[model samples]
Target: MNTKQMIKENNRLQDAMKPDNLSYYQDMVVYIRSSSVEESKGEELLLEIAQHLLDAQAKGKTAEEVFGSDPESYCKELVEQLPKMKGLNRLQYHLMIPWIALTWFFFVQALVGFITTWTGGPVERMTQVRISTLVLIAGGSYVLIHALMRWMKNDTFQPDEARRKINVRSMGIYMAITVLILIAGVWLGRLLPVLTIAPWVSLVLFLVGIAGTKFLFSSK
Candidate 1:
């Protein structure tokens, strides 16, 4: 199928994404020379790709062999050989991913902080001994989680125009409550090294919160 067809296919996929995530994918499609339709070309184009896949399958080609085992590895290989340009290029953009990831790290940490304060706690631990440890562990864990999440997103392999992105949805009360709990968990997790949020106190709170969360989420 043509690029127009591919982008339409992509937009349908984007609808499932969070707004920012949808915008990112839409921009990716536009940047990649695939954006060409207001309405989706997803179904038609997907049919074409599917037909091709079917043909390949009939010939016993492995999915990995057909789709490529890893686009990231392929992208890396391309960058290795792609000449250093006078100005920015795709390779340079790939480097920006690390910074983008760092941005996400800080953003998530900030979110955790917000989650804590909103749920009646602080994101940063109350003491210095935990401070460096929090920074190191949270920073490292952030990177690992970010990579894992991104990989999962990539593996979903929806086109840049995918229509149904996840994020910023109005699960409303339940999500709010869960995020509150998450914020508290994150805050307490920060204190794990120091054995803070003492067992007796936490045990009672945990049971109560668990009951609350279950009830809220189960609510219509």
Candidate 2:
């Protein structure tokens, strides 16, 4: 089965597990799927593990007893054994989020320009952004994502309630940091060398970004 098929099957099988068992198993699932391992391989391993867990459940075995206490370590071991995404594939994987954000940023600017022209207001055909602002936004995004992934890895072994709390707290922190990044970018943009981009250019870039992103992320 493909990754999507395995995911659906895994979900159906997981629904039959006891709440505690499902929670425990899900941590491993999240950690493995989020790592740099190949997608199909990761989902295949998860489906296999899910099936094993269900079989164990029939014998009244808990997830912890079946998979041991250190699920994170087990997942780490499996990730090591799995084939890692490399070269252009790895580049595409990592750049997917940032590319989408940049694409939408251009799209919004282009839309605003068009709207201004249509409304008979001052023709705003140009958008200016500073080099320093671009650097900070990209660097900050990478750091934030890296930190969040680390948090996910570390939180995998915690209890269900604790995991939920961690996730909520992490999300809050992530949003707060994002706001700070945007504010800093705005401040730096005012002080740095500005590059003016035309609406037509932005529209072209938005189109290219969309096509590139679709190519990079499309399921094979």
Candidate 3:
């Protein structure tokens, strides 16, 4: 079937299934997409999987029975079997890391500044040396994270359609979370003078928390 027909059929299947079965189907698609190396291939796989699930449901079978007990392993095997695409150069990937890190660093800094101002704390201007150090550390962190993902073979396929979905509500939620984190960081910094003494300490902790969470979730 064509893409539009596939999507419509998928939606129909989702509506027909019980909530629990629908959840299982969604989770399977998420797993398959995560394992896939190419966006187009991932979408195709999702549609195919959805169709299979629909057929199984029509026969009064559960998703588990249709796939297997270990759906994640099956998805991983499927990913391994997919033909490799001519991906970006390894050097290019490495080079983009620092830029991504730098963007995140500035975003956090801006959030912190706004939080401190709102909390009636004196916003301290960072010294050039301190800023430079933070930039270096952020760059280093990006390299370390990339290396760790590669070592674990958990590097995500780029251009994910699900990730590319632009939801204004999601963006608002993220902004709210950022504000909350900044406020919490400022409060914590006040309680522990070390974080205040070294402003980047909180940033580092935040980054570490994110990396740790990603690792834990992706492992499953």
Best by TM-score: 2
Say what the RMSD of model 1 is: 17.2
Per-residue CA lDDT of model 3 for 71-161, tens digit only, reads: 6577778878765434542333344556456546655765676677678787765311244345444555564554444422321222245
How many residue pairs clash in all the candidates, one count each?
Answer: 25, 0, 0
Candidate 3: global Cα-lDDT?
0.56
TM-score of 1: 0.24
lDDT of 2 by residue, 55-120 (tens): 999999999899898887888888999999889778877787677777887898787767776787
* Cα misplacement distance, residue 54 of candidate 2 (Å): 1.9
Candidate 1 residues 131-209, lDDT tens each? 3334444444444444444444443444545423422222343356456545755786666654243323333544554
Off by over 4 Å in 1: 1-87, 123-220
In order of TM-score, best first, we have 2, 3, 1
TM-score to true structure, per model: 0.24, 0.78, 0.44
Evaluate residue 195 in candidate 2 and report its C-alpha lDDT on the 0 to 100 scale: 74
- Candidate 3 Cα errors over 4 Å, as ranges: 1-16, 89-101, 108-124, 127-220
Scanning candidate 1 in windows of ten residues, the lowest lDDT window is 31-40
Per-prediction RMSD in angstroms? 17.2, 3.5, 13.5
